[model samples]
Target: MNGKTSVVKHRFDIKLARSMFGAISFGMALTTSAFAFDPLLTHGAIPMSPAAPLFANTGSGVCVFDSMPTPLTLNEAIERALCNNPKTREAWAQVKIRAAEVGIGRAAYLPTVSAQWRGVRDETTTNVTNYPQYSSNYRNSVLRTESVTLNWVLYDFGGRAAALQNANSLLEAAQASQEAALDDAFGAVSKDFYSAQGARGAVDAQKEIVAAAQQTFDAAKARADKGVAPISDQLQAQTTLAQAQLDETKAEGELATAIGTLNGDMGMEPNTALAMPPVDAGVKPDAMFQETVDALIETAKASYPSIRAAQSQLDAAQAKVRQTRAEGLPKLQFVAEYSHNNQPTTLAVGIPQFPATGHEWYLGLQVTIPIFEGFVRNYQIREAHAQADYQHEVLREAQIKVASDVWSAYQTLQTATASLVSNEALIEISRKSYEVSGHRYEKGVGNILELLSGLQAYARARVSWIRAVNEWRSARLQLAAKIGRIPSR
Candidate 1:
């Protein structure tokens, strides 16, 4: 009966030990699951930023182009550039980085919680030199400890607020800078698209000249065969035809180059082929340009992304100065900690070990006063002030530059608009002259030189007209961009 009782007691002790260990392990797991393993800590330990949606799937995979439009339009090209260009992606990344910084600054206002768990298998041996009877005693035990600590800054004399404000301002600056970058890309793609269309138009003009040259060559050859004209006339006509063909070939090459540039700007391979619709060169004058240049300048200064970015940078720098000043003041904090330890202890040799468990906890407020730190804080504050001053100048320079850009674009648009009328009239006059000279040569009344001269002049006039149309379109778009009216996204 006694043996059965001893066996029952041993089983009960084993069960009790297992329950204690399970309870401790379960408590530690709960602590970690509630704090350390929170979902917010999964994404690089940063809270989800408000800008997160804008940059979604950017890092998931690179953009793929399945099929291009049959005839890509200017708006489509701008959209592709904004979506796939490396420059836009880089700008988005900058915004994400700033957003993460803002999250970190906000985290400073929250309490920080940490948990620790430790277990050790310890073996000790003791020897008594004077008493051999008490020598060679050994003790074996297990030790377990668990702790959790929480610290929160209750007050910092505005240091945390300043830091958070600095972060917010920088985030604003990054967002504005991104807009500026996208607008620049939009303008670039628009110009390249128009330039490519112009090149195509040039090719068309060259084809017309080539046909006219061939007609002249055929007429001279027919007259020479009938002995009504000299062979030199036929030879000159043939030479003119060859020159016109060469010009056509050159124009085609220019068109190819322009298309390649447009492809590259759209974040595609340079050699990628793209079909583009012919640009409508009959753009009417916009009433927006009728406003005074000074008024436009004022509008741009008020809303231009570059100016806004500069202003935000200045605000961030000023906030940094305030943060630096606040860092030198005293801070108040709240701290709490809880700890537990369990181990086996033996008081003397030949005595069985006894299990001991202990727990400690404390909650209190802490005051941290900053004394002399080798004048580091003073220098930091000075540096911040200097930085603020520099940013102020940057804002001023941005305003000046925006004004200059508006003025230049406005003047360029006006010139391009005026040139369109002259170019159109020149084309008409040159075309009539070419036709008249061709008719006279066919009737054996005009020389080869007069016909060739008229042909060359007409071709030049056509090319000039194409250039004028492209310039007008480009100038208008640039002015709109300068006025901060271009939508990048």
Candidate 2:
């Protein structure tokens, strides 16, 4: 019987150890998981701007880039800017922050569980002073306690719901603001790209003028050597060639400056080397520009990211008002706790110490009502209402400003388009007149002054034509931005 009893006790001990091990393992798993989860993991569930992930960082503070392209296109430039620029990243970070807030809001609907464990060594020293013959007594014991508690807010009179809605609205607003930042970056990079292209075109045009001047100088020198033209003609032609060379040099410098600006816009060092393909000859204004200004303004009002952000802000503020009002009401909560303790008892001076263990469980409903707090709740509600009203005006102002921007951009585009047409004609006419004057001077039928005048006119016309082209391109992009769209590459 003793042997059988020993076997049963050993088996029971093994079972008890296994149960404790399983419980500890489960608790450890839960703890590890709680720490391992990140708020960024919730981004997928939140509303995210499409532009937020363009050329996203691959790792912490690590943006990957292979090599710069030799002949980069406009789209490539835009991508590079988006990838490397900090403005869009800042906006994207705001989206993440707001997303975390949304997680906090959703978590309010769930219960919080906490576990606690404690151990203590207790010691006591006692002396019977009233009886002179009594001796001192010393005692020591070990105590342990373990507890698990759960608290859940069952009701808050709509405060939690309103707060969650506010968070969700702000998250949406953050996403829209991110999109607006991206649009700004896109517009800026495109403008720089076009400006660089125009500068390059000016340099090429200057080079062409220089070549023409050189040819004229050579002709006049040859005529002067043969005694057909006077030395004055050769002198004048040489001066013209020198002026053209100086202008070409200036144009080259301007081109360099433009390239540096474009590189900076792409988030590169200003002195970084950059190569870009020439603007396409087939490129033209977008067909969308054909719509009336009124129609365009209406479309912009409906879709502009700024307008969307404002609308969402208004929603968030309204929700805030609701939350503030609910703060004055009562809250209801459910509370529960389970606890166990192992303690030794020594009640009297001569009493022997005895081991004791106790288990306790509690369940209760908690109600909290806010009566008054120096009228703070009332003021908070008023502040929230004021903020909501302010947001409403902000939304209206955003719409009005977007419409005005569309109108201004539309007018600028119209003017640029008309100027482009006239400049095209002017360049052609000037080119023909310059050619005729050059031929006449070569044949000794026109004076050096006449030829120089025609050459200067042609140069001016070429410069004007280039400016007109760039203006038209820029105007189109501006209008597209106002309409909350990326300019077509």
Candidate 3:
């Protein structure tokens, strides 16, 4: 059990040591480089990017189209937007970062290992007065030692456990946040798409008005030639035709703007031309809102991503309270080490080599209890308590907002539906009036002004019908998102 009696044999091969050292140095030198990686030059970690090799669906090469091609179906448009949208990707990144935090929290339980290699040379010179004490005028010696050390936190009064739980809760919160971002993206894309469709519908209606105006102009010219109408009547018809054409041009411009906005929402180039059919053709399924507002609000409180995210944050804050409380408690740790020492023979001293390899271990319970911390530990506990309370309030607010959003969206849908019915009636009445006015003018019984009035009223009714359909569709998307049903589509 004594030191000298427990000597162990060891070998020191200087040649082998030199070669190993040279190899390691050479390898590290070869691996070193001046060039740095550029993230901007390559494809990044987009959540569902089309460029992602794991993705299966195809997109239009991120707005590579020089001109408008075939219209995209609703499903295709939603898929593309989900893939390329920046907000979705950003939320996805947050999830990943929080997941890494979970790993960091778990790491607190593991031991920290460190190794060191040290070599030293000592030289000294003495005068003749001390020549009898030291026969040599100069003395030199070399020593090399290597050691491996470890430190492990044996216990921490539940601090590590609380931290791990906090990390897990944060990760869940991040995941819920990601889902919320996706829901938001879906709502935005749907609104933009339907708005574009509405604009296209308006353009088509304007074209019909222009065609009717052309017909009126031809009839006026015919009557004037037959001496049944004055030249002023023909001029009036021509002016109507000119104004109708201008209206059609303006509608086309507005349609272009809406299409650009939709493309931007999809994370594509704004200038990319994307065409779509009229709103009627792309009308989504109109399911009636049979559920009461209370049921819908309850569903939102339970299932909405925002609500789930807030709940997760509250859990994380509670864990943080535990972690902070433990900070003022006692902790325990363990320490151990292994070492090797070599003293090689020197040509000048004619001394024999003395090299030894040994193992050393230190095992004990270490305790650390905080005494005076400038009230920092107390402040941390209080702050965590405050944060927990704040998170609870935030969760309540999130639920309230979810219910409010659902109610608002429901009201909007109802209003849009009622407006659709009223618009339909208006369109029917305006169509009949236009027909009667056309007949009267052809028979020389009504003036050009009355015919023009009927035409304008019909055009307005048609535009309103198109917008009402889009508004209702957009409202449905909003409600579905509020209730966490966006991915159902």
Model 3 TM-score?
A: 0.81
User: What lDDT would candidate 2 get against the real structure?
Assistant: 0.81
- Candidates 1 and 2, the one with greater TM-score: 2
Off by over 4 Å in 3: 1-69, 120-142, 343-359, 487-489
Cα error of candidate 3 at position 256, Å: 1.5
State the lDDT at 157 in candidate 1.
91
Q: Model 3 over residues 62-159: C-alpha lDDT tens digits?
A: 32333334786655566577767888777877876786677778778889898877665534333223233322333234467778888899888899
**Which candidate wins on TM-score?**
2
Clashes of each: 0, 0, 0
Per-candidate TM equals: 0.84, 0.87, 0.81
Clashes of 1: 0
> Per-residue alpha-carbon lDDT of model 2 for 206-302, expressed as tens digits?
9899998898889889999999988998899899999999998998898899899888877888889787666444267557689889999999999
Q: Candidate 2 vs candidate 3: which has greater TM-score?
A: 2
lDDT-sorted candidate list, best first: 2, 1, 3
Q: What is the lDDT of residue 346 in candidate 1?
A: 65
